[model samples]
Target: MSKDQVLDPGAIAARLADLPAWKEADGWIVRTYRTHSWKGTLMVINTVGHLAEAAWHHPDLTASYAWVEVRLTTHSAKGLTEKDFALARKIEEVVGWQPGLEGGALEGTPSDPRFAYIKHGR
Candidate 1:
């Protein structure tokens, strides 16, 4: 995916089909990861940063104590693009991580508050 190419609605929809956990919102593809604790939140942010850095396509991150929202778009392209989807896919791979397990379950305690900010499975 070229960083310079902006994806049209059809193309965006096609890409989004493969990324069910993400949605196109306010001109960006976004996903919010819920974590069990403050530590989990930081872990997610750090992991996202690492992936963004490695891919050279960054996402806008908003993180609180137990969740981090990642929004991806090609800033230079001024719209959604393949690069955004590529990065989003990579992020999904790492974000759905469970230690010593292959995407077993989300990492979080069941006792955490079920607020909007606190996503399920943390």
Candidate 2:
């Protein structure tokens, strides 16, 4: 299909299987990330902002002291599209990364409650 083509319900449902944290609602694919604090919420927002800007495919965000909801759809296509799924995957990856679990040089944020940030989904 073309880049801007709108995905039908079946296609959207199939695509959502790869994004368990997200769901189809209205005309958008949406996900909500819960954070440990206001700081974590801001971090999630900023991280999403950077990704959206870089991809040039922005998403609508709803944030609070401990949560952030991301809603994505292709405005030009007037519905969900590959761009929405692609960006959602990238956002999920970066937001959910835990370097500590990966045994990498970059140890992720400390487990200490004082330093904990996102309340990563299981």
Candidate 3:
């Protein structure tokens, strides 16, 4: 696939099929990850930054106490390209990552495993 070539509708749809958590909006593919705490939100943002830097494909990120939205598009190519999907896949791999292997998920407690996968309740 050409790195700079913007994908057509059929191609974009086919690629997007694999990314169930993502949707195209306003000429961009986007996904929002929901977390249980501020720590989780921050962790997601940092992880996205690492992925973007590693892939050399940056994305627009909006982060809050319980949510982080990642928007991907290739500005240089002026549209969506293979690079966007590639980076999105990489980002998805660890976006909802629970960092227990790094010794506690969020620096709160190893006992509670920090704030990951917390269920919502009224």
The parts of candidate 3 lying over 4 Å away from their true place are 97-114, 117-122
Off by over 4 Å in 1: 1-3, 103-122
As a whole number from 0 to 100, the lDDT of residue 36 in candidate 2 is 92
Cα RMSD, each candidate: 4.6, 0.8, 4.7
Clash list (residue pairs), candidate 3: none
- The lDDT leader among the candidates is 2
Q: Give Cα-based local distance difference scores for all models.
A: 0.80, 0.94, 0.80
> Residue 100 CA error for candidate 1 (Å)?
4.2
Candidate 2 per-residue lDDT, tens place, 4-112, comes to: 8999999999999999999899999999999999999999999999999999999999999999999999999899999999999999999999898999599999879
TM-score of 3: 0.81
- Candidate 1 collision pairs: 34-122, 35-122
- Model 3's alpha-carbon lDDT is 0.80
- Sorted by lDDT (best first), the order is 2, 3, 1
Clashes of 1: 2
Cα deviation of 37, candidate 1, in Å: 0.8
